[model samples]
Target chain A: AQSVAQPEDQVNVAEGNPLTVKCTYSVSGNPYLFWYVQYPNRGLQFLLKYITGDNLVKGSYGFEAEFNKSQTSFHLKKPSALVSDSALYFCAVRDRTNQAGTALIFGKGTTLSVSS
Target chain B: GAGVSQSPSNKVTEKGKDVELRCDPISGHTALYWYRQRLGQGLEFLIYFQGNSAPDKSGLPSDRFSAERTGESVSTLTIQRTQQEDSAVYLCASSLLLAGGRDTQYFGPGTRLTVL
Candidate 1:
């Protein structure tokens, strides 16, 4: 089975400051990692994904994530934060060896609070 | 590009009643998925469908929960004899294809089911 862990329940950062939301994963083989953000009462929106290649992956809304295979982490990052960046962020993983119809394993999610 | 859509954005039902939630995937998407999100929690996979192949129902929590998708289009998830524990937001997502990480899953607004 595959799984994702988001150790922090909530994250706080000041506007214009760099922010990071940590994520870790466990899978049988190579992992397909992804990040998503959710606004109040809305479904999760795709941010980015890490399939292979470069360890650093860029995503929507000026978001980026770094895939550290050795550390089993894929932490989401932003060079500058905005108050509007506050939302719930999720980390997900899919085991590459799993069948075509396998579903993503998600973490509990981290609530981001970017204060002005 | 309409993106994914779901019907009955909110639902309130009494215990022992059966409820059905609907989802319309983005056009041309061949992979669809169902997930449940309880309050203050992350997504929990329910089922997955790729094209017309048999669905992967491993994530289904119980036999009372069932889902069906027709020809890469709309889908309906039916929950029989709803329980208080069944109260949660039912989310639907679709992807163009399911080949490793290239297939990005787009999500819908989700149906908030409140079992009374």
Candidate 2:
């Protein structure tokens, strides 16, 4: 089985400050991790992914995530937050050993609020 | 090129009625996915289609939830005997069927379904 857990339901950050949304996962084998952002009343947008190689992956809108194999974590981070950056963030994963036909499992989601 | 697109951006129906939602994946995308997201939650995987065949439909909530795709292009999800609990944003995503499912999925705008 494969599962992703976003430990925070809501994260508050001031504009220009750093922000982090935590995510952890459990899988039978190595994991393929992904981050997606959803604005109000909009579909999810792909942010970044950790397939192999680099532990740090940069994504859209100045967002990035670090994949730590030892910790089983992939946490989304931003160096400077903006009010427009507020949205719902989701972490998803699929076991690398699983069949390619299988769908990715998603976390419960974290709501990020960047106040001006 | 156009990203994934879903039809009937919004649909409102009475319980017990049948509704069909459509999705058009990006051209040349070989893998398509269907997911459901309720208010304030993350995406729930419903199905995965590679080309025209669905190898995993295990995420379909019930027998009433069914979907089919045509040779890596269009897909339709038909919900029979709709219930209020089925109301949510139905999202479609498409990606290249790369090895180990390492491709980043592009998403559609999503169809918001409301069952009264």
Candidate 3:
């Protein structure tokens, strides 16, 4: 079985400060990790994905995530937080072992609050 | 280009009643997916459709839940005998298939379903 875990329920950060939303996963064989953001009353937006990539993957909205295989973690990071960046973050993983008829398994999500 | 779109932005239904949700994927997208988001929780995979392949029903929670896609365009999810537990935001997403399964899914605004 494939699964994703987001340990933090919420993360608070000041504007212009670096922010990290941690995510870890368990899957059979190699994993394909993804990050998504959702604002209030809106659908989710894809941030980035790690699929047989370099350890570091850059994504939309000045966001990036590092895929750490040894740690089985893919943590989303932003160099500087913006108040507008406050939203719900989700981490998802697709099991490469099952190439067909498989959907992404998502984490419980983490709320990010960036204050001015 | 227009992104994925879902109908009935908000729906309120009574328990034991039947309800149907619709999704329109992006033009030329070969893959479509449906997900459910409960309050303060992560997105749950519901169903997936890719090209002409048999749809993946593995994610559907129960027999009461069923979905169908017409060709590679529109999809409808029907819930028979809806329950309060079925009250959640139903989201639809579409993705262009890429080699090595590196597709990025674009989501719709979602239909907020509330079962009374």
Highest TM-score among the candidates is held by which one? 1
TM-score versus the correct structure, for each prediction: 0.98, 0.97, 0.97
TM-score (chain B only), all candidates: 0.97, 0.97, 0.98
* Candidates, ranked, lDDT: 1, 3, 2
Best by lDDT: 1
Q: Write the residue-wise lDDT of candidate 2 on A1-116 in tens digits.
A: 67899999999999999999999999999999999999988888999999889899999999999999899999999999999999999999999998774788899999999999
Query: Model 3's lDDT to the true fold?
Result: 0.92
Question: Candidate 1 falls in which docking quality class?
Answer: medium
What lDDT tens digits, residue by residue, belong to model 3 across residues B1-116?
Answer: 99899998999999999999999999999899999999988989999999889888877999999999989999999999999999999999998887666678889999999999
Model 1, native contacts kept: 0.68
Docking class of 2: medium
lDDT of each: 0.93, 0.92, 0.92
C-alpha lDDT (0 to 100) for residue B8 of candidate 2 = 96
Over B37-107, each residue of candidate 2 has an lDDT whose tens digit, in order, gives 99888889899889756348888999999998878779999999999999999999999888877878889
Model 3 residue A101 CA deviation (Å) reads 6.1
Q: By TM-score, rank the candidates, best first.
A: 1, 2, 3
Looking at candidate 1, what is the lDDT of residue A22? 99
